[model samples]
Target: MIRSYEKTDLEEMVRIWYEASVIAHFFIPASFWASQKSTMKEKYLPLAENFIFEEEGQISGFISLVGEHVCALFIAPEMQGRGIGRALLEHAKTLKGKLSLKVYKENERAFHFYKKCGFVAASEEVDEYTGCVQILMEWEQVR
Candidate 1:
C-alpha cells in the first residue's frame, strides 16, 4: 500500500535514505550519506511532499518531491526489486503533470529504470551537491 507520509514515518524514511544512498551511490563515501542523515530528517524531508510504500505494516520505500523535481526516492536496501520504486514514481507522476529528477551518471541501474519508466535524459551536468556527473531527466504525460 502507498500513502502520504506521516510524521512518525520520518525516522524510517531517513534510515532508508541513508542506507540506500550509501549503497547505491557507492562512488560517494558512506560518511557523506551518514553525515547527511540529520539534514535529511530535519531539513530536506520537511520541505518536500513525501509518499511511502507500506507492506505488511512496515515501510518499504519512499519518494520525495520538491515542486516538480523528484528530490529523492529510496527503497530499503533489503526490500529492493519488488516494484516499490516504480510504484512510488508512478505516484509522483499522478500528482505532477510533468516531473524531473537528477541521478548520478554512474548509477546505471537507476538511469535505466528511469528510462524504462518514460523519462528521457534532458542533459548531463555536474551535481552541485555531490560534485558528481549527473543526468537531468524529465517525463511528461502524453496528451
Candidate 2:
C-alpha cells in the first residue's frame, strides 16, 4: 500500500536512503551517506513531502518531493525491480502534474529508469559536493 509518511517511518526510511544511496552511487564512499544520515533525518526529510510504499507491514521504498522536483526516491536494495519506484513516481505525477529531478550521471540504472518512466534529460551540470556530472530530467503530464 502507498501512503503519506508517518513519523514512525522515519528510521526505516532513513535506513533505506542510506543503503540505497551507497549501492546506487558506488562511486561515492559509504562514509558520505553515513555522514548525510543526520541531515536526511533532521532536515531534508522533514522539509520535503514524503510518501512510502509498505508491503506486508514493512516499508519497502519511498519518494520525496520538494514542490514539483523529486529530490529522492529509493527502494530497499533487496526490494528493488519490483515496481515500487515506478508506483511512487506515478503517484507523484498525479499530485504534481509535472515532475523533475536530477540524477548522478554515473548512475545509469537510475538514468535509464527515469527515461523508461517517460522523463527526458533536459540538461547536465556538475555536482559541487561530489564533483560528478548530474543530469537533470523532467516529465510532463500528457494532455
Candidate 3:
C-alpha cells in the first residue's frame, strides 16, 4: 500500500535511502552516504513532499518531491524489484502531473528505469559535490 508520509516514517525512510543509495551508487564511497543520513532526515525529508510505500505496517520505500523536481526515490535493498519504487513514482505523478529529476549517469539501473517510465533525458551536468555526471530527465503527464 502507498500513502502520504507521516512524521513517524522519517527514520525508516532515511534508512532505506542510505541503504539503497549505497547499493545503487557503489562507485561512491559509503562514507559519503552515511554522512548524509542526518541531512536526509532533517533537511530533505522535511522539506519535500514525501510519499511512502508500506506493506504489513512497515515502510519499505519512499519518494520525495520538491515542487516539480523529484528529489529522491529509494527502496530498501531487499525490497527492490517488487515495483515499490515504481508505485511511489506513479503516486508522485498524480500529485504533480509533471516531474523533473537528475540521475547519476553511472547508475544505469535508475537511468533505464526512468526511461522505461517515460522520462526523457534532457541533458547532462557535472555534480560538483561528487564529481559525477548527472543526467537531467523530465516527464509530462499526457493530456
Scored by lDDT, the top model is 2
Q: Per-residue lDDT for 143 in model 2?
A: 94
Estimate, for each residue in 49-138, the C-alpha lDDT of model 2 and write its tens digit.
Answer: 999999999999999999999999999999999999999999999999899999999999999999999999999999998889999999
- Alpha-carbon deviation at 122 in model 1, angstroms: 0.5
> Which 10 consecutive positions of candidate 1 have the poorest summed lDDT?
122-131
Using TM-score as the yardstick, the better of models 2 and 3 is: 2
Number of clashing pairs per prediction, in order: 0, 0, 0
Per-residue CA lDDT of model 3 for 1-143, tens digit only, reads 88889999999999889989999999999999999899888998999998889999989899999999999999999999999888988898888889999999999999999999999999999999799999999999999
Give candidate 3 misplaced runs (Cα > 4 Å): none
Question: Model 1, 44-113: lDDT tens per residue?
Answer: 9989999999999999999999999999999999999999999999999999999999999999999999
Candidate 3 positional error at 50, Å: 0.3
Worst 10 residues of 3 by lDDT: 88-97
Question: What lDDT is obtained when candidate 2 is compared to the true structure?
Answer: 0.96
Best by TM-score: 2
lDDT over C-alpha atoms for residue 123 of model 1: 96
Candidates' lDDT values, in order? 0.95, 0.96, 0.93
